[model samples]
Target chain A: MRNELNRVVMRFPSKSINEGLARSGAAAFASQLDPTLDELGDIRTAVSEAVTNAIVHGYKDEIGEVIMTMKLFEGDEIEIVISDKGCGIPDIDQARQPLYTTGGAERSGMGFTIMESFMDSLKIKSAEGKGTTVTMRKRLNTRRYR
Target chain B: MKLIHDMKGGLLTVRLEGELDHHCAMDITARICELIDALLPPRVRLDCSKMPFTDSSGIAVVMRSARAAQGIDSRFTVAGLCAQPMKVLRAAGVDRLVEIEEEVHI
Candidate 1:
């Protein structure tokens, strides 16, 4: 395990509007690591996907609390965890599959696929009626300057 | 998000400005579909040059737009996608569903 250098925890309502806030906040916090434009974009997109799942899938039609935790390690690595206490995923494998969604016609079902591709690693844990939690990690490329 | 539509000859071009996400996808998709259903143009084009950011929700917008255009027998094409949105679209294999062009001068 790398030494934990800094961390931030945010708690907000599981509203559709908060999706943008979550991703933008994640990008702002990740900027401390001096990530490049591509890295920042990847982080923002991954965060958006996870937060959207929590809001759209986890809580369903009801409003609940969505918690996000971001941690930075010694080696330019960042880890983000997004969790929601809502109706959990019945099948994690199926949910992770690309284009597989219960989110109706408006949903592309590509949330998990985008997150998995953009980040280095992804882990999801869920219980039928309990809740869902997603954790993702990525290490930015080392740069010569600063 | 802002949507600008230009209908010239048989082409209906809709320009998207601002971020496309779940928060705004519903309205955007509906507007585009409404336009397609009303105009029934021979060709439909989405200009994404000004759209700097998008999530999987953007995929839904694109897919819905494509479906709307298909309903009217209109050809659909997406042009001038920036890097991040393009990555998300390609990751979802959206290029296979609709015609994707890198840039458009006009």
Candidate 2:
């Protein structure tokens, strides 16, 4: 049996807006534990949504760095922290709403919703001038390797 | 994903083989849109039998595809959705927007 992997960190500038990079990073990180496609998809979606939110909403077309940190805990749960040093959400409540969008035409405001739906647990912190950080947790029950 | 189309009849069927996440959502969406616009299909069927997992981005892509089909006056139906994808669609209230075919035994 392979030992559970600990953590991975990746950083990308907001100007690039490459979805492939984020998803590939997620797949590679989760593949270390030999998770099933179902588990992998769940983690991939959460990471994608988080990275997208950081790029589109937090950075808001401005150039900044978005960092993603992923760590597996106790051979069962995965914790992920995605952060961006950009414009933060003034009103976190309104931002978390299902379809409430600050962006006029570019964003759909579904990033947080998708992240919450895919991950087991999600927490967000942001300040007016400071940046935003999103911490998400996902549990892996089955030991299937694929 | 394997997409089969009957151009003369204006019918397109898409068989999704694996998970539909951000990795494949854009590609699938672009392909579906191109086919629908190019052929002007009367109806489109999305077969999700083999698709075990789909994320919210996948749902967004599906919504976009459905909207594109509607814009062209084409009917779109999603069929053979298993547990995971079905739950995600239901949670997102996508069934109300698109016609989803339930399990049918032949």
Candidate 3:
């Protein structure tokens, strides 16, 4: 949200298959910061989690669009935002708790958990019936968590 | 996602390569189940050395795989995991139930 450095925005259908595209594209873009392999992998997994949530929880097999944006700050900081115009979470606190999932059978409920663990910062904004947005940030030059 | 399997009587070694996410978890699970049904390996080990990335869906598929093997009275283990997937599996609490081989690097 600071002074614009460089960014990429893309909108795609809320489909399961597009998750890979969203993740890989974001990883490729974030490579500009010269992130380590582990850092890149974490970023990829985090992006995948957010996009998958938009498709499974937000859209829920309904036709919708998931918008993603990646931006770079001057100090080796990268920010990613994934948004969806679909059903919003009524209880974000419960949703953030590990193993809390609406899709009981298939979902692991670790979507937000993984995103939170891998990224340095995570923020979620949502309104019932309006939409949800997940924003995560990380500094590439920081020491690796591993 | 690609799955390489070594079906030798009662032991099945499945090496999964590529990124496992929501996009391919279901299909991969189905395929692995198909092989399990046909081979009937008493012990199934998943080698994740080549699988560089995974998400919550990966956890789901792995848990399902573990359940599938248990349903057949077989042992299911995450044979090897690199750094990233290992961190995810541990955070998901899968390390408690599923047997994972240590010493795998990122």
Off by over 4 Å in 1: none
Report lDDT per candidate: 0.93, 0.75, 0.87
Q: Which candidate model has the greater TM-score, 2 or 3? A: 3
For each candidate in turn, the TM-score is: 0.97, 0.74, 0.91
Per-residue CA lDDT of candidate 1, range B33-56, in tens? 999999999999999999999999
Steric clash pairs (candidate 1): none
Error of 1 at A81 (Å): 0.2
Worst-scoring 10-residue span by lDDT in model 1 chain B: B97-106
Per-residue lDDT of model 2, residues A1-146, tens digit only: 33446889988887433655777787787776677767777787678778777776788768788898888876567888999988899999998998687653324457688788878899999987689999998877656632
- iRMS, all models: 0.7, 4.2, 1.1
Q: For all the predictions, what are the DockQ values? A: 0.86, 0.20, 0.75
lDDT of 1 by residue, A14-114 (tens): 99999889988899989887788999999999999999899889999899999999999998899999999999999999999888999866789999999
Q: Which has the higher TM-score value, candidate number 1 or candidate number 3?
A: 1
By TM-score, the best candidate is 1
Candidate 3 clashing pairs, residues 3+ apart or interchain: none
